[model samples]
Target chain A: MALKHSVSGFLADRYDMETATGFLRKQAGKRLPPHTSWLHVFGSLSLLLFISQTITGIMLLIYYRPTPDEAHKSIQYITAEVNYGWLYRQIHAWGATLMILAVVLHMTRTYFFGAYKKPRELTWVSGVLIFIVTITFGFTGYLLPWNQIAFWATTVGTESANKIPIIGEWLRYFIRGGDVVTGETLSRFFVVHVIILPWALTGLIAVHLFLMRATNLATLEPVGEEKPIEPKHGIPFFPVHVCKESIVAVLLLAVLVTLSVLAPWEIGEPADPLVTPEHIKPEWYFLPSYQLLKYFEGPYGAFFGIVACSVPFLLLFLWPFLDRGKHRHPKKRPIAVGIGLVGLIGALVLGYLGHVSETEQTFFGTRYHIDHYGVPHRVADKSRDEGE
Target chain B: MSNRFLGNTEMNEPTPQPTRRSFLDWVIGLFSAVTVGAMTIPALAYFWPAAKGGKGGDVEVKEAANLKPGESAIVQLQGKAAIVRRDASGLVAYSAVCTHLGCLVKWDGARKEFLCPCHAAVFDASGRVVSGPAPAPLPAYKVKEVSGKVFVSTT
Candidate 1:
């Protein structure tokens, strides 16, 4: 204690430690709105997942080779040979899915609570951009595994850019760093996934947090309304809100650990550009868009498909400006609630279709084959047909 | 010393030359632009796909005499998959990449066609799309028979 005091005193004499420390103390002890709920924990949970990803990603980089020839080999080496590498890899893989889930859930909660209003508009905009960055993180990271699914999925994913009129072809080439996905593409994705995205996300998250702090959490009160938080009356951020967040974090970690252990991610066959896997589907988060794109066909299909995929993001980014209403409660906003429900249901249905596309399934007594466009056709009953 | 300093200052102070300040600003701006361009140009160029990536000469598949009629061989040409088939007419070579989604196609001797396992896209012996979701046929490559050996041009 004496040594600690002396060191602190020495530093205090040289620097304005008192004010800096006091500011942090004040922030910690700040009173949160009385209406703060457990649902508010998702944003912090998303941050926790990002931290986990960063740690595991660094661990992975130790052994990961970005070259096409060695990328798969390196993954195999990490999974099979490196000490606790499998654990890190599994956590990183599972963390990405959970991070996206947490971000979506957080956004959903914010939307329902009508938090993205007036002072919180910039917060919502930053959050949406962060979501986009998070998705790019997933897309770029997916290819690092260098598996057949990654290869073909990337091929399909990048090919969507080919519909963009004048810039379409160049965009595809730029993305791939070539006419097709190759070693160059792997290198580009590696640099992007590892370096570019991490910095981008970190910067965006800082902006988002700064805005959140500046604006304060939106309450159930109407838009543009303010409730002065009384320190004694409101919940203290340090102990009360922190405790709730800790509990959620612990639960989320447990889920992540359980997932990592039980169903560890598999290192599939090395990417062979020549041979494509039979069922090449992207990660579940992209399924909705993937399935949506399949509905468009013919000369104008690509252009329209690009537009259709972009509509949701565009709407989401500008939602605050579009919905300039005073009411914060969903009960007061019937149309907004209805539209949200429709979008949610539509995405869920589309994701299901994407998952079940190009597969054979049995419904009741009949076997049906789901085709490329996710349309099901009844297969002839072999036994009955043969007997007849 | 004060008198001389004042005299020097008076001599230096001409009509406030706004052009000098503007010229200095322009110089700084030009220098900044040059510095940025020096970095930006190389960075932008770095992203462009290299002119040469895999070896671009003829890739020898095998001896022409060894590959029997009704048989096919899958080989790497210019680091891309290419299919070579031997028939009674001669040897024919085509890019193995499927037009539907860039999956490699397999030669099915039984079906006398190139079959893409993904999406079940099929291409006939002549590299024309036979069925399935493939919008275009497999691209054909030039095949040359030199003495007893067969070579596929991957340029």
Candidate 2:
């Protein structure tokens, strides 16, 4: 008791500890809906990953040279020379992937629970904004490595951004800071990645959290019931919810570390503007859209492709208003659930398709020999270099 | 908040004792605790940078004088198994990572083929998959003998 008093006294002397503690206690005591499970952990997990990324990103920045000529060399120095630099770099890279995934799952969970209806509309909107910002962060960060894959992937990524009909050319030029991806583009991306996006995302996240806490927590049932059910006893946010959150964060961090240790992130050959790789692919998160664009050709195709890709985001943003049915149970909402399932399955299929090489087939012997690209060609007419 | 007829202690119901439900709870709690501990230790270690080893770059596997015709040696090339074989033609090196799922491939001297134990995928002397579920031929690395030392470089 004496030790606690001294520590409390010291903290109080240094700051407004009492008031801060009171505020925290009040926030912790907030009543959270019952039936909270592992599905609800994604938001906190994403936040944890975001925090990890921020710390590791700052560590990387100390050694990372943003200049085009020096960037790749600087990265190599960090990986090969700096103490624990490889760990930090791998954590940051893997963290970004995991953060994106967590955010997606969190959003999906929100949708599944119909948590976006009515009072939570602003929170949902802010979450969607954060999702966009996160993806943008990924797009900007990919080029910082300044490797061959990064260079070509950025070129392909920006080229696709150029397919946005009227604003296509301007958007491309704006992103690159010139007609081509050169030193200027690198500088622009570096500044945006390190400074601009972080600030914007932080501000947006603050608002998101504020909105989330300001409203009552959504439950399994839809709001606006004609005959209200008996109010269920809510669990306190402090000890109960916080304990679960900590457990999830710790487990996730452990998993992230294991992955980092097992497979240290690879740095491909340094960027050579003169050469484009035989096959270029963007980061996996963007695969669905990339695959979508491949099926279409010409200006009209590009226009339609852009529209098709935009539809999901549009639907997501407008979901609360779109799904106005009284029933929140997934079984009762067949149409909504079916649509979500289709979108998920389509994304998965497209993601897989995007990573694979497309090859044409030619008639061969009964036991046809498949080529490198999975294309079959006749052994009788096999050329010296038929497929890649 | 007073209950009626509380004085009649003999009529009161007996308090429920712990049952199989409590036992199940204890089992789950113990399992969860173990799982959490198991995850935490390795995760903490993973944060530290792995020790640097001379594995990935140009690694000298064997001496040219020691390896005769039809002889093979499994060398750790960049933390992956690589087989260096000396035949009548010259020295050849093939990646030991199987094409199917990256299981380490083993050299079979009698059969003269590289075999994956995971799924029984087989690669011939040239690192081409002869049978099973492997999708692509094993990657071949360039091998050079300089001053009687065989150096293998992964391209």
Point to the candidate with the largest lDDT: 1
Docking class of 2: incorrect
C-alpha-based local distance difference test score of model 2? 0.77
CAPRI rating of model 1? acceptable
- Looking at candidate 1 chain A, the ten consecutive residues that score lowest on lDDT are A293-302
- B19-52, model 1: which lDDT tens digit per residue? 5555666688799999999999999987787745
DockQ of each candidate, alpha-carbon based: 0.33, 0.01
Each candidate's TM vs. the true structure?
0.88, 0.65
Tens-digit per-residue lDDT, A9-86, candidate 1:
999999999899998998898888888989899999999999999999999999999998899999999989999988
Q: Across residues B64-108, which tens digit of lDDT does each residue of candidate 2 receive?
A: 348788887766665456778888899999986665433457778
Residue-by-residue lDDT tens digits, candidate 2, A229-323 = 23357777778888999999888889889999997789889986544444466789998987776555433665677788889999988888888
